[model samples]
Target: MARIVDVNPALVRQRAGAASEFLQVAEERLEFIRAESGESAEAQVAASNAIAAGISAADAICGKALGRRANDGDHRGAVELLDSVKPGGSKLALRLSKLLSDKSQLQYGGYCSAAVARSLAREARKLVEAMNEFGIRS
Candidate 1:
């Protein structure tokens, strides 16, 4: 089980709202981000936004359906929680995994290549959209 904390069901919309906003920022960054360029600053920014989008989307989904949000330092726990959600949760979990997998490289120091950056953005968008499809988004 993941280290998750209880969240009020009433805050579902708030979390969903944040997810949507983060997704928007990620989308915008992906568009302007010079993926093939040597400038790592833009890649880091885009990747960071993508990571944030995934985290908030996961929070919204978990809170709305399970009344719990991942609170641990390890993100894999959150992935496990999403995988436990019914129906299409497994799919969402896989996509979220891809985004989270790049967190360390993008956030810290590991060389976030263009392909990795693009992949993170793609996964992040898919997760947010899937969360919306699950009827849990605000």
Candidate 2:
């Protein structure tokens, strides 16, 4: 079972708000740094923020819909929790899972290419959008 954090409505809004802020940074910085090489630490930062935003978006969705958020070391647990929240939850889970799957490589691996960073940012954006569709309104 996914470890979970019981959340109130205020916490749900807080997570969604955080997700929006992280996404804003990721989107703005990504445009300017997209041309930079993957070795560019700025690009990596932007990508890292994107991944953070996606995670926050997932938390917001689950918190709003299920009154709980996944709190597990394995991010797939987050994905699975999201999967059960709504009809479109699985799609949101897929996006979140993709971001999580790439996290180690993008953030910790030797070099994060601009291409990979861009791809991750795109997925993060989609995940945030899905939060709105799922009624979290990030």
Candidate 3:
């Protein structure tokens, strides 16, 4: 069984700050995608990376507030951890799950369209917002 440990308040604040920073970068990348009219692997990869960065920001927030870090190798583990923090099958959990599912295809192999990339960016924004709210709640 995994146990909840003590997280330093200073660390929590630091993590939250980092999350905010990442969210900003993710938003900027999303904007860049919006400015581009056509689809490209580079755009897809950027969108995917932005989503991953958003996830990382959320993970940092959850770790600080919940005192449990997600397993590095398992994206699902990160989702589970976020769920633990938010509970009740929250939208945040659902969005994270979807984004994680899309992440691999966007990053590695598969066809990623402009629409898909845009959708991922929107989801990433939502997740980042949720993380920000969670930080406030904590």
Candidate 4:
């Protein structure tokens, strides 16, 4: 059984800041796919993965901040992390939970669409920005 660890506020804040940076970069890549490409299927898939990675990383940091261990298993891990964070609510967490759940569906089952990927990325950006608002600092 995995256990949640109580982390220092300063460390949590630092982790949140790091997660925000990574997520920002991921969002940028997703946008680059839009600006550099014509929203191709490959671009959409790439964007989806990028955002997923960003969310995964972001959730991991937030989870740690909130006294949870965001592990692997994608969506399941995300949900567990959210639960660890008290009431478990955040736009980024919600969006990520959804996307992480269907990532295999998008990648293997070909459900990834340019519009959907872009939307997910946008949501993730908002979440990361929100984390910054929560006193995350370098």
Candidate 5:
């Protein structure tokens, strides 16, 4: 049988607030990336970081709302947990899955291009907005 645990609204609120802060930073970094000239490598890196941070923020909000930490080394487990909470195979989950899968590649490899970075940033922004709309208190 699955164990039931009490949900802590205060903790959820705190997590939501933290997620909001991370999202703000991610947005600022994305804006910086947008303002850069001619596919700057620095901007690319910033965009990648922003996307990663935005994904983390969204995950935090999902965990808080579900009253459990949605963490797993494979990341697929986190997606499963989130899907359990907000079913229907949401777009946010799909985007997060892609971002999480590409995180290491973006951070360590030289394969990230300006166009890819911009796309990731846009997806991250959408995920953040969806989380806010989900009433995570941010």
Candidate 6:
């Protein structure tokens, strides 16, 4: 039988909202790259890398919130734990996310593109700002 569990709706909304926003930003960047560069192999690769970085950040933030909720015995509310967290590791996550993905390849043979770097850098800035607004630091 499925048990009806009481969960904090606010928390759930916050976590989901943050994650969704992160994903949205990544997608926006990808779309822009595609529209501007068409099917150029290098452009496509760069876009992929940038999107991957955004994914990494989103994953890190969601993973941490979920972990915290689990440790606190709030399984039902785990999906909404972002609101309860004070954005502590978000900055590090943002920076690491970009570096771990496409940013590191900015100087590669077919990777050094002004547009790609700009997009990734801009996304990183947006993420940092969002994390800060949520009180995330690191």
Top of the candidates by lDDT: 2
lDDT of 3 by residue, 41-124 (tens): 646765666577556656666765677666554677667677776543356777788888877676677646667766776777
Candidate 2 CA-lDDT value? 0.81
Query: Best-fitting candidate, measured by TM-score?
Result: 2
Question: For candidate 2, lDDT tens digit of each residue in 1-138?
Answer: 767889898888888988889988887877777466536766777788899999988889889888898884668779989889776887888899888987888766765767777888898888778777767753
The whole-model C-alpha lDDT of candidate 3 against the native structure comes to: 0.63
Q: What digit string (tens of lDDT, one per residue) describes model 6 on residues 19-98? A: 44544554554545544433445454545444444433343354444433332323223223333445544454545445
Model 3 residue pairs with clashes: none
CA RMSD per model (angstroms): 2.0, 1.8, 3.7, 4.3, 4.1, 12.4
Query: What local distance difference test score does each model get?
Result: 0.77, 0.81, 0.63, 0.55, 0.60, 0.44
**lDDT tens digits, residues 1-138, model 1?**
568888886676787777778778766766776558665656667778888888888888887778897884668889988888876889888988888887777767855555666778788888777776668747
Estimate candidate 4's RMSD in Å: 4.3
Q: Global CA lDDT of candidate 5, please? A: 0.60
TM-scores of all candidate predictions against the true structure: 0.86, 0.89, 0.71, 0.60, 0.70, 0.31
Candidate 6 lDDT score at position 17: 52
Worst 10 residues of 4 by lDDT: 83-92
Lowest lDDT 10-residue stretch of candidate 1: 33-42
Ranking by TM-score: 2, 1, 3, 5, 4, 6
Mark the 10 consecutive residues where model 3 has the least summed lDDT: 1-10
Return the lDDT, model 5, position 48: 66
Which candidate model has the greater lDDT, 3 or 5?
Answer: 3
Off by over 4 Å in 5: 1-11, 34-39, 87-89
Locate the minimum summed-lDDT window of 10 residues in model 5.
1-10
Candidate 5 — which pairs collide? none
